[model samples]
Target chain A: MRLSVFHPVSSLIYFAAVLIATMFCFSPAIQICSVVGALLELFMLESKREFFRNLRFTVVVWLAVAVTNPLFSHKGVTPLFFINGRAFTLEALLYGVMLGGSLSAVIMWFKVFSKVFDRERLLYIFGRKTPKLALIITMTRGFVPKLKAQYRRICDGRKCSGTYMSESRIERLKASCGIFTALCSSTLESAVQTGMSMKARGFGTGKRSFAHSFKFRFGDGVFLFVCILLFSAAMIYSGTGKLRADFYPRIAVSSEPLPMLCFAVLCAIPFILEVKESLKWKFCLAKI
Target chain B: MSKKTFSNLIFLLLIPLLCVAGLLFFRDKLYAWLSVGITVLCCAGYFLHFEGKEIKSAQLAIISAMTALSVFGRMCFAFLPGFKPCTALVIITGMYFGRESGFMTGAMTALISNFYFGQGAWTPFQMLVWGLTGYAAGMLAERLKKSRPTLLIFGAVSGPAFSLIMDLWSCIWADNGFVPPRCRKFFVRLYRNDAGILVSFKEFLCKITENWQVRRAQSR
Candidate 1:
């Protein structure tokens, strides 16, 4: 009873399909999907410890967005009321929570998507003619790691110098200036070095071939087909002119039932699959 | 890039960004003292970095005085209700320094200060706008430093002019937050508010603008 999940690409296709569907539904369904998606991703950490290593930053970002958004927006009718002169409206807080959660979820999902359709895989799929696209993929994939590593090294260097005084404002600013100078210089150098490395490897050469790790099995075909169906249905719903933006002082209600149901079905697919896989894993582990 | 350098930059950027977010969120309670404290801290930070050199002392004293003037102007602006003269602090610093230094100062100041107001997503844009204003002021300062009267004029005009520039940036970011769909009226009202302050300080604006225009026109 070991749980089996779709390949990353297939998983991504399904997620994208669901997202597009939810967007077309033009109601509160998008918020639900986003929150559910974010929670499911978060739960991945709780249930499977290994996933946390990859998702910790993402989760923090999501939480930050969720927490801070409500604090600032201060909109809506439901009176949570009274922080100083400002009346923190229940509606604004809730909306901000939804908006922030959804925004973070979408951003994290895209991050996951990039991880799934990794630079090498995408490059292999797209081939050498598209250098700009390849460069973008490489940078996007590498960005977080680069920033994280850089942040750590600078802190370490400061610590080693015994100049790392977190308590003093002036000391921190000097350290920051030193760090900024160092960062700008190194980044420029790295850009040049990376360019040279690419050239040395004959990046522009037409002789390169890529063999992707993901093979399109029968299951993959089913996943892709289902995604296509979902995406097409979503697009059709949008074409009928029912999709609308409800963001402002108030959230809008959707008129069409067909769009809503179809949207719900699409958005709920990933959650269903994830739950199925998790439960299956649990049952199998119990037997052991 | 070396791992060490990259991490350092992120850490530096993050501190100010988070601080600003905090500032923005809590600005109502903290605005009066927080702004003054940050302005002092920035100048103090500069002084501490250079230690006890004679030139450093003079520069530090000047910045300290500037910080005091900025706070005073800001407080006076509050009383005047719509006079936003303190936006010149970053611009003046930038003008005196070069563009790069001005940019760094402006960005860092805005980011750090915004923390007291309460940090949100808008912090980055404010940093960028303020940084750009500083950079522009620095570039302009270099071109006008030749004559005493022109320098004085530039100094006088920079305060209110920068408020206009910063407002334009804020308008772009906060349009969704407060502005209605038909925002032409809003822009007009904003322009009127800004222009009204300049009109009240007519002598100051006139002196600065006259000198600025004469120099600018001469250069052309």
Candidate 2:
């Protein structure tokens, strides 16, 4: 199994630590480390084509954030140029790029996060904490595809009946609205039926027991421990003015090397694990 | 009035004050706290309002179904730029079922859909905006039920409202402080596209009402 598919708790802790570090740490070095780590992890877990598709999204977000920041924010002393009467500062521009990079890094991490923690994992974690909420999430997940199918069926039916042949904007709007109203009513009606069936099955009567396929092993425990230790160490360094950056008056970042190294190690944890796992798998396959 | 109604009234009254406080005092440092605070307050009010009455499984299912429908509706119309029925569905839900249900549906829809769209700092703001639209629709449910034109107007207004609230987050994040001129520019650019969706949605609602009336007349 992949390293990220470890026990749910381990997976959550690792992702949460990396995401928090990525979001809170303002140092450009740490941000770049996170972006690289996330990209490497994605490449390891997903296909090359998938990685490129995801990269497109991150690049767009990064560019937008980078370009817009300097226009709205005129902070810092080093003026690059005057843009439409507003002073565009070098610090602000650099800060914008850093912000965009961090934002993209966060987005990439979440992409990995969503892949690891699918609906089943989320339900496993949240079921005991809040059963009703978990049930609602499950129901919502189930309903999305069903609703899409229903919409297609409705559209096809309308087309067959010559009702969907509308060239005017108003006629198209009416047809779309008609389709939705039908969908809304039918879904609600079916929901009531489903609710009745669930009630009859003794739902919401008492404490519910969920069957989970995840097993916590000694390796998972050790993995959690190492993640927690590294995450806390990185956070402590961040708190002690080691990861500080000032972008307002001028661009300044801490010259400390130890904290940056610690952050780099923390961000690289996932990529390292994935590489190790794949190497082990390859060695075993060669022996076989 | 019952204690719950009185408390809800007070909560409604405090929303404006909260907005003003976030704008005037807590723009830089406490902005996240303020956004989280508003979300928590709205959710707390929802739960409190529904306390003691076992919100039946049917009710939960309906909320889930409606939220799913809205999210799917958004996905289906992805080819159409900015034309989504998310707000219209929320309005209809609020009109039929009470305010709390409306709020729950809107907030949950935003949460679940963000799983696909990629969650960010802006998710909470989107939830708050959609939730408030549903809540306001519920508040004026009586009037909206009586008049289709009023419902259309409300739907139109809500489209812009959702866009404006979303832009507020971008404004705060981009500027790091509230700058009126920049905000106005951003709002205009963003709302211009969103306004098309709202107008289309309004027209859709009007068409639906007219068809319903005609069908009723024929049946009678």
Clashing pairs in 2: none
* All candidates: DockQ: 0.03, 0.35
Q: Evaluate candidate 2 and give its CAPRI docking class based on DockQ.
A: acceptable
**TM (chain A) per model:** 0.61, 0.94
On a 0 to 1 DockQ scale, where is model 1?
0.03
Candidate 2: where is the Cα deviation over 4 Å? A163-174, B1-30, B33-53, B204-220
Q: After superposition, how far is residue B51 of candidate 1 from its true place, in Å?
A: 51
Distance from true location, Cα of A189 in model 1, Å? 4.3
**Deviation in Å, model 2, residue B25 alpha carbon:** 21
Clashes of each: 26, 0
Which ranges in model 1 have alpha carbons more than 4 Å from their true place? A1-12, A21-25, A45-108, A111-129, A135-166, A186-201, A234-258, A278-288, B1-220
Q: Fnat for model 1?
A: 0.00
